[model samples]
Target: MFLRPAARRLRADHPLALELAVLVLALAGAHLWRRGATALLPILSRAVRVDGLVTRGLLAGALLLAGLVLYVGVYALLRDIDVGLSVPSGRDRRSLGLALAVPPLLVGLTKLVGDLTGVPYNGLTMSAYGVGTPVPAVLASLVPGLLVGACSLTVVCQVLVQGTFARVVDGRRAAFLTTVLTAVVLSRSTGGLSAFPARGKLALAAAFVLSLGLALYAVEAVERDGVRYLAYLPVTAVLGLVVVSLIAATESVAELLFGATHVAVLGLAATSYERTHSLLVPAVAYLSLLLAEETVVLLFEAGMRSW
Candidate 1:
């Protein structure tokens, strides 16, 4: 089933001290390395600003390499030392369609509501931007690499924040931290919230009702698709939004919420992985979200140019 939680209870055979020590050491090194690498290549830090194909391709490839080495290395090292979770051989695939399809619709609905009400919710990732991503040449040249790199980066974050930390900390706290950490990491790279409104009383009411409807519909759609635990994705995002609203100033809410939602989506993917032991669920979802998002952006940009 899609979004099913893991059937097994938490195991604690590994030495917590060793696992944490290694993870901390690796993070320190990774931060240093990222600093140096990004200094040499600004594209690593700001991928969305570039429209050129070569720059985008290089950026994707670099992120893919870094993410793969970091995550695969940590996972392998832990597994070798008997401190890691093994990759499951099982697979569950019923949720891919919803995963691929929902992000764009949600984003589009946010866009539509903003157009009507003049207030938009905060948005999500813009690094998915690729000029004419559907163009055969663009698709062949940079899209695949970017898609894979995104998946790699996302998975690495989850492996560290969710898989690793969950072992040492309580699940709820770990989940929250996962959002906090991921928001910090991605907030800069991702663009702001769904878009504007809520400035005026009328606009606020419209945005709220429309957003609520979309949220409710999204959850219902997930349920109708037979997803169980994963349907709570919107609620998880709310948790992130609430926490950020309390701690952050109003201006920063959208960017912070972007990261929170990003983490929530990945959490669903992680749950799928836990239940089935396959990576396809997350990869497909991310790829779809990007394509769907980019398609929306592309058409909107095109419409604006003509308008």
Candidate 2:
């Protein structure tokens, strides 16, 4: 059943084409958004200057609402696909879980290492400007972060789609290609975030390799020993500590919250996918969390300015 020829051909042809199209469209959308935001900055500045706390709050609320709407639309689209796809097999489930877990863990490790080594990990940042900045200026600061979130979502969706296709094709080469593509997509998506220092870049590279290794090991272990292999929760706990420590080390409460929310959402998405085998669930969950985090941070910054 896993190696059916019809499945192989369907996977080899249609999914690859669909993935390529999605990648092209996503890239185009991101590029256009960045450019359009840049062009609109002056006009936005004039129109939405945050002169008072009320305006700041209003701006925050508006952005949050917009984010929610976008997420809902995406979720609806993904839900349609979910209805058509079958639940994955046990092996596929394990593989998906590992795939989802690795990337965010690696990101957390890079952040921890960067903090410890005095290198700036630029993978994620909460604020682009100081509090009390004009509403447009604040919005401008958020634009890049939102773009980064969008880029990350695109990468995750592509990874999930490609990974599913690889499984359907039942080819080791396809799986390896999926892994490589995932790594590449993640590395590229970081560009939308801050610029890393030299050491930070090296740390990120190392983390990527380590994550890929861990993911491979986890999937193999699960395949060999079944779900019992996942019973080694202590190791997972230690990794969780690494992420928590980094979050605690953050300079401010807002930063801490943002980091925590980021990791939590990623982990939750992975777990949800593992249980449901619905890619849409994780995608929508992650997107919603991203939006919520952005909203909270924006509101927090506005509040700080008000005080």
Question: Which candidate gets the maximum TM-score versus the true structure?
Answer: 1
lDDT of model 1 at position 243: 58
Count residue pairs with overlapping backbones in model 1.
12
Per-model TM against the reference: 0.53, 0.35
- Tens-place lDDT per residue, model 1, 1-307, is 4222111111223233334444444444444544455465664446467656576666746664665566556665665422223443423445555556655665665556545554333233433333444556645664666465556544555555456666666655554555554443333324422111122322322333334334444554454555534555655665566456536533444434434445555555545544544455656656665565555555554323211
| lDDT scores in order | 0.48, 0.43
Q: What TM-score number comes out for model 2?
A: 0.35
For model 1, the superposed segments whose C-alpha errors exceed 4 Å read 1-28, 39-56, 59-75, 79-91, 119-134, 169-185, 188-260, 303-307
Put down candidate 2 lDDT per residue, 1-307, tens digits, no spaces. Answer: 5335433443355555334334334434434444455565446556876666545544543453344335434633663323214455665555455544544454455445545654343324332334565766655555555544543453333333333444335444443454443333332222222111123333433444334334434554356665545544544654565455455556543344334444444455444454555555555554454443344335433333221
Worst 10 residues of 2 by lDDT: 188-197
lDDT of 2 at 186: 32
In candidate 1 the C-alpha lDDT for residue 170 amounts to: 60
